[model samples]
Target: MKNITFCDQYGQLGGGQQVLLELVKAALENRFTVQVLIPEGPCADKLETLGVEVRRISNCALTQGKKSVLDVMRFAMYNLSVFFNNFSVLRSADLIYVNGNRLLPVAFFAQRILGKEAACHIHLNHGKLEKKLFRIFLRQRRTSAIVVPSAFIQRELVHFDTAFDSPKVRIVENGLDARFTSTAFEDRFSSRPLRHVGIVGRVSPEKGQDVLPALARRFPDMDFHVMGDAAFSSADFYATLRRDSPANVHFHGWVEDLPQKVREIGLQICLVPSRCPESTPGHSFEAAPLVPMQMAALSCLVMVRRLGALEDIAKSLQLISFDSDEELIPMIESLRVQPAGEPLALCENSHKLAVSRYSHNSFHENLKGLLRALIPV
Candidate 1:
């Protein structure tokens, strides 16, 4: 079996780390000897549970929102240590897969010095400087593939540098498990009046969790639930949210089984109030967020902000999209008073699209094919 080493910067179970776990499982199913190099956290534990080799590394101490000059210097210093520490593991693998953009510097060094072939999977639409820096490493001969989860990210890259418009760039959308899609339609659809609304993701400024208090105050009768924790650099935001939120707003911190918890809360509507990149330059925007598809599969009506890949996914799934924070109130009011059948029809259609277009089986096959092709014969 060919060996494949996957490198990731974060140890937390965020969206990108979740995707990395799925990719590791796919590699194992294809009979590839899989090994992961990541920081010590839940992600490494999950990989170990799956019977894959896991190596712990120092955390990449990059700032989450806006990076300062010191943040850049610290990350540069961390990259040097990463290069020396993980060199052996990277050299032994037939294919080196860098799962996040922050890990690209080490991947570039490995490809240049060790003559190894590497693939970089970028999950977010980065800012101008980051995009330019990425182009330098991605343009190298040893960087075999530039994998992005959505066409929006591909467009973002190409818009910045036309050189990214090459065959090496590939779009592989994130997928949901079949169990979510297999949830019975009638079980999820209810004629009862919808009262519960949920916002699922990390509690951060860009995630727009700050807007939830205003929404809670606007709709007193409706309960708003936040189904995630203040991971990374959002503890202050979380504290502020707790202080300002009305009685109708609830915070369910870091759920272990998110899908089941979502069902238990009986969420009728899910919101993706992510901030647009036009307003915040350095902050990362959502690129193919798995929450919308997950909620759609569970038959919850999804409404998203018209930003990045969210707009594309919303258009494809026929979900609602609002351009601003003010627009959400009116949109939610409309959905609240609309005919039950109308919302049910939309949810049913979205569920069907999620099943047919973004199933886990299809994701595994496509990722497996990519890994197989990248490995030398």
Candidate 2:
């Protein structure tokens, strides 16, 4: 079999990017001769440092500068670049993996253009317009399979395109490193304040961070920390959250060692209040539910809005949930009375789910099985 190749837009630290990187790392470790193509710069540099073969593409104009006609032109140019870049890689690979529905255009085009076996992983769930556009995108391709992170997404894809079935659409749960299951949370840091409630993800409007101010006012005694850098969609919204917040609301910009930091600060609980149907680039509910399990590995409790795929995971893991602030308030307040016990067992079980069900290992295995049925033996 030809080795697999992975492609993503950038190395910006987030769930989708994180999953791709982790999978890339694991693929390399498994001696699969893995290669990752990324829009050039720091992300490419980081991957090179990790000893993975990196192909830096000049496509994708991502900058702190404001948007303009030239920027749009540049973005279009990058899409062309993405097409050619992946087109070149397709020739040498047995399988191509594309993360996120946004990049489906490039992968789908490659498969149709080059007759390569490519997989488009759907990491986000959408409503109407998004579903329509995605279905249109999928219709254009006569390629490989469609991978979804949750059954929620699987159902949504089928709704948009009724022909979606086992060969095309498959479900994979988001996975966590099993080692995180053994990492312990320590309370040695004095900087760790009481009732520290953290919300992590790109600081954006869709995340529904605007409610933090009201939440802070509701529970002045507890500290609310928002950890994530802003994307264009949510930058202004994030500014408003900062401008109109109480002292209890704190913002920590992107940190490289996030999982470690979450452990260091004794992140007793993590909250994700997403306004969208609960999505971040990769996996369901922005894959924040995994945080609770990671925290559960360390015995930290996760209290999240009953959004996205989290509702299912929360029910499976028995994590906490609330509808409105009225109900959410009491749950937050109750945490002040007690911190959760060691959640190692729950964390281990959750990690196992990631590997057995969500990891690329499982994804590829399913892909192989599907191909066997689709192609002549």
Candidate 3:
């Protein structure tokens, strides 16, 4: 069996980390010797429970969202220390799988020095500096694959840098686990009129959880549920959201079984108000967010902002999408007043689309095929 060493920048169970866990499980199932090098946190703990080897590493201290010159310098110094400390682990592995961009530079360096093959999974859109850095490192000969979760991200990368247009780039859409797909269709929608809305994900500036308070204020009769906690340096933002939220808005911090909880609350609509700055080509903050799909899989109507891969998902799933808060307000009003049958039909169709197109089995098989191809005969 070929030994694959996976490198992740963070140990938290974010969207990218969720993808990593699925990939690790796939590798183990396929009889590959899998090991993960990540900071000590929930993700590392999860990997250990899966019977995979986990090695603790230093966490990145750089601030989230935007980084200053000092932050970049400090992060570079940290990366140097990480590289020196983990050189032997990476050198001994047949392939280096980088789960996020923070570890790309180190993986590229290892590929050049040790002649090891490398695959990078790009989960988010990057700023100008990050795009430039990715272009420089990904052009190396030893890089085997550049994986993207959506065609939207693939287009954005190639649009920014033509070098990404090469054959090495692969689009592997994210998927929902089998449990979600197997959920009973009849148990999804409630018989009563749907009035509650939900905004799920990390409460960060980019996630635009702050937008929910205003939305809640608009619809006083309806309750808005926020199902997530502040993570990845967004604690202040979460505090602000709580302080500014209206009386109708409720905050449930980090529900472990989000799908079941969402169902229990009987949330009919999930609003994804992801921010996409004009300065960036695509939605740099959110590329292929799984929350929308997860809600869709649970037979909930997902309304999203017309930005980045969200638009792609919306189009594919036939869900409602709005360009701004102004459009969203009227959309929510319409949903609140519309007949139950209409919304239920939309939810049913979206669930079907999600299950058929983005199941965990397909995700595992595709990822396994990609990795197996990298192994020699």
Candidate 4:
């Protein structure tokens, strides 16, 4: 099969992009010819490094950010550029994998013009209106399926538009590369004493870093280490976090060696304290597989705020759950006092659940089946 995956540059190398890359890599491994359409950045470089063809497309202005005259000019230029460039590729693709929210219109137009299969894979939780209109606009077109990472998102889509009862809708929970988890699970601890609690992914308001100071003050004995960069849109928010933060909080700008960083800090726990509800959080979404199974992998207990997909993943993994700091206090204290819990077998069970359900191999098989159904032999 010949495929084209669409994405934006805003997220750069964000989690959604990582998930897109995983699918593309799998497609290549399965001997399916693939091309990726995206705004140029680090992700393009990474994809190129992996031997996948990359095509830079101009983004519509209104779709990108806040409205202004400058944005309007840029939008006009972007649309013109995209309209002309997309011609050759859209005519060539057997399938167009739409990865971003705004890229829907382009993919819709492409499929209508070329009579190819289009798949809309929603990454985050979308609002009511967005979901309602998207279903109405794309359902009867060349769209073969609508995919989401969690059941919460699937429910949200159907809630917005009851017409989504069609068999075309699918829930493919995000998966992790099993090999990556293996590396982390084996090096969970070292000779050094555990001193810090680690939080991974981009630092933004939605991520709940604003509440970090409060969490830090409550737990003075342990350090809070944030492992990611600030979004350009949320730079001021990140600045406030840095300026007002206490000495106990350490912000490591950006690190490529995530598993090694977890090893170096001898991190005993990974806390995901998100303030807002995520549609499908990539950091926690993808990490869910590792949290449960990699006991020998990381010896770390995962703590998450009771919101979005984390709630589902935590329940599935059988990990401990807490909603507020008051509740979290006891949970953290319990872990501090006891080193003995259930056997590593429990962790292994969680691992098996994660790998079997969310592994890349499983995702590839599922996607291939969907593609074949969309474009009949």
Model 2: runs farther than 4 Å from truth? 40-43, 58-77, 85-87, 127-142, 184-194, 231-233, 277-289, 337-377
TM-scores of the candidates in the order shown: 0.95, 0.77, 0.95, 0.83
Global Cα lDDT for candidate 3: 0.82
Query: 305, model 4: CA deviation in Å?
Result: 1.7
**Candidate 4 TM-score to native:** 0.83
CA lDDT, candidate 3, residue 112: 75
lDDT of each: 0.84, 0.61, 0.82, 0.63
Which candidate has the highest lDDT of all? 1
Per-residue lDDT of candidate 4, residues 1-377 (tens digit): 55555544343767677767777776675567777878766777778888877887654535222246886566556644664676787677777777756666556666666676778777776655457646865566667777776787767667667787677787776666544444423323243333567677778766666666776787888788887778433677789999988889889877666666777766666776665434333323222222333322344656667666767777776655667656766766665565434423344445555555555567667666655565554
For model 4, the stretches where C-alpha displacement exceeds 4 angstroms are 1-5, 8-11, 58-81, 184-194, 277-298, 340-357, 375-377
Q: Tens digit of lDDT per residue, candidate 2, span 1-377?
A: 33667788666656667666666665554456667877664556767877877877654544432346886567667666677755666677766777664455566666677777677666666545456755665565555666676776777667667866545666655655545534544432233434667877778766667768988998888778887778424567677889999999988887666677776665656665655523333223343345545444444556666766767767766666776656766766665554333333333454454334444455445444543432323
Please give the range of 10 consecutive residues that has the lowest summed lDDT in model 3: 276-285
Q: How many residue pairs clash in each candidate at the backbone level?
A: 0, 1, 0, 6
lDDT, residue 133, model 3: 75
- Could you give candidate 1's per-residue lDDT for residues 1-377 as a string of tens digits? 78889999888888898889888877887789988989998888988999988999888776655689999998888887888887888888877899987877888778888888889898888787778877887788888898899988888889888999988898888887544656655434466887989999888878888788898899998899998888665688899899999999999998778778877888888898998544466444787799999888888899988888898999889998888898988888887788888888999998899877888889878887877777754
How well does candidate 4 score on lDDT at residue 293? 32
lDDT for position 109 in model 1: 79
Model 4 has a clash total of 6
Residue 73 displacement in candidate 1 (angstroms): 2.3
